[model samples]
Target: MNQTQQMNNDAVVEVLNASGASDIVLVCEHASAFIPTALNDLGLSAEARHSHAAWDPGAKAVACEMARQLDAPLVASKVSRLVYDCNRPPDAPSAMPERSEVFDIPGNKKLTRNDRETRVARYYTPFHDRLKQVLSTKPDPVVVTIHSFTPIYQGIQREVEVGILYDQDTRLADAMLEVETGTFVTRRNDPYGPADGVTHTLKEHALPQGRRNVMIEIRNDLIETADAQTSLAIQMSRWVADAVTQSKDISCRV
Candidate 1:
């Protein structure tokens, strides 16, 4: 973590169901569209302020619901990705993307090294630090990160509704992909993959520790409505719970 500028006192992360005993920890990297008071909307247009470029539209809702259903602790970032992408490392260009899809982030444009380091310290560091803290509490942990992708990106239309993404360790991803996806066109690493740098959260938080981890991507269009979010969450809860159970059973038998 780079630290040229002093970090802010604002809370950059949220941990829900902190006391839950479940062996799972949920993470939502693009949970909020809240840019800090200092960034002035990250020089975003009125439309871009809350666009998919800023945050995953319904990721937090679904994550919260899944946390409730599974009685798991969720560590979610509270700031917009335009400020600093919590899932991305400071060195990654996408960590402070100047361009997202069709929107241009004027605030992130022409950033200096110090400026990038400051944002990393203020947003990225604390977010993952708290995540590490949350993970430290669990005896046996299964890391699950929640995200939502756009139905259309740039000029292409994406057909995959759910994506199970992973890096090196695919225990959870393998089991999760095996679970029934109902009507969702769930696939292994569709839309985005490890090559796309979408699995930084899994790589940083789960892989080195040898924990079972999977990143779940729900198509934003499917989770637009509150009811739709809840309905999808119910189905997702089953997928996750069943997968975790299967993993534990296999481990015990081994």
Candidate 2:
């Protein structure tokens, strides 16, 4: 299905609503399942090529919907995470995983130092650099990263429907968690947490800049379709808006 194709820096990174008026900035690191021709589908089977390891299913649609509702800028990666997980740092092993869950990625195994460095330069750098450029345009940006996790990982079931993640700084996460979730269960750092290395994007792009940020993890099953993605984005937009307002109010408190 056209798995082999060329990619440029611009093609790998996508920026939607670059001039969007809102101060919130959205990022979806695992937005596509595209394995460039050079990578040769990462030597994955057809099923593995479209698995969660390749990308976070339906996350890009939800992030796009949220961006439209919030009038915010969104920076997304167009390449598969198997190539390089944009959420991870260059040094992290998961950035280019040899195995994801049950699948052994043949193309990712036995990498020399130069191979790792080359991928870091090609995939990770361009994605984050574009993100930095977008954040630079905003006077006061609040970073919100969007992601989806399988309800069942390695045969274990996860109960949390929405996970709000934070590291050293919890300004945004605290506020978002305080919002009453309706039917869907909401938890603070369930499924994965700081120790899981999921907050690299927030730590790198937002915290040092003194900008409020949070990582959102939704159960993939909840956002499996267009209507579901829209529904989820609508709810998340409310929580994010309220959280931003709450954070700002706390700042202005007398």
Candidate 3:
């Protein structure tokens, strides 16, 4: 365990239902908006800390509910994405982004190489390592990363409610999209695609190992309330269960 002490104190990665039996493994990379007290909120305004740039609101709730519903394990990052985006590789510029959307992060502006590396070690590495460890417990696990997208980005309004994203492997994503849900509009990749470099976690964890995977993004407004979050989680849990069963059936035949 190369876990950094500072990040450990913050509980960088939290695993729920570690011994769960379901083939699905849930991951929430932006589960929280907590920045270390020592960092001074990463030099952002109070409003920015709770914004989409810092964390995916309602994502952790959905992931937790789905995990319970499906009897699956969940691995989530506790620190804010602004401190260190767990989804991104250490080398990516946005891994410790100085600017996110329209907000400038003053703390990240003049970072030294060591500063960046320290963040990676303190936050990113432990989160991913814990996720990997959880996945290693199950054979042929389906990786489903839960995320929330702002309805409007940079003044552009996104109409799609659910975005099921995948890179080269689309087994789980294709299955998910095939599930019938008349309530919300589901698309392959609408607001943020693989071209947007949002598939880092799936690519790093699922792609190389040839595991089934999908990155699900829901509009933040759709799940702004607790009732709405639970409703969406119930709907998503059924879809995920169906997708996992279908994918496994296909794999067995091949």
Candidate 4:
């Protein structure tokens, strides 16, 4: 395999490694450190939303560890979420963010259809296609997309340790509640809502199939450290394993 193929064949995105344990398939659409070379930082300062937009700072570590522990496959994006959010639909505003928090991305503003197509062809399409390909190989696997949120966003304090986001898959959500019950304090879609469409991966693939699926959001502050990442991965792995067991009755809608 060539370099690109080698990378793809090995790591899940540019970060996560596909697991070989459970039937669960994990996705981290924001796991990346890449800012497209053509955009040249998208006209923002090095510190301005770079870490957040480029990647979920600390999420990849936990995601990688989770893949390892669960022995499940993962499909993640190699490009920055700011370039084109893999979780969002092709037309969502955040799908091509002009302003993420404090930084204004000039390159993303007033995108032509061709420009949009370039990003889609380059990043978005490949990611989703890979996801579909992975799922096709697995049989009714529980889809779990991992993401991390800033501890504080736009001056708002987010207190939830984890957020279980889903539109319809109550099985995995209920299982998560049972696992983390009274312990870690998981919010049922507190930080963000599914209607926003920023997290469309679960919606597009997971929920439609009536598969046991949930997007787990860990506070970025909690998993930035290696020890914390490992701990969180182990905890999440147990819940995922439980959810997999519980999902035996889930009929695929695909």
In candidate 4, stretches whose alpha carbon ends up further than 4 angstroms from where it belongs are 1-19, 250-254
Which order, best to worst by lDDT? 2, 3, 1, 4
lDDT of 2 at 52: 93
Every candidate's lDDT: 0.88, 0.90, 0.89, 0.76
List pairs with backbone clashes in candidate 2: none
Deviation in Å, model 4, residue 50 alpha carbon? 3.2
lDDT of 4 by residue, 110-153 (tens): 99999898777677766777787777777766788899888888
Ranking by TM-score: 3, 2, 1, 4
Which tens-of-lDDT digit does each residue in 123-220 have in candidate 3?
98888888888898887788999999999999999999999998888788878887746678888977778898899998999888888889999999
Poorest stretch of ten by lDDT in candidate 3 = 1-10
Per lDDT, the best of the predicted structures is: 2
Pitting candidate 2 against candidate 4, the one with the higher TM-score is: 2
TM-score of 2: 0.94
Reference-based TM-score, model 4:
0.89
Regions more than 4 Å wrong, model 2 = 1-7, 249-254
TM-score between candidate 3 and the true structure? 0.95
User: For model 3, what is the C-alpha lDDT against the true structure?
Assistant: 0.89
lDDT of 1 at 116: 93
Cα deviation of 211, candidate 2, in Å: 0.9
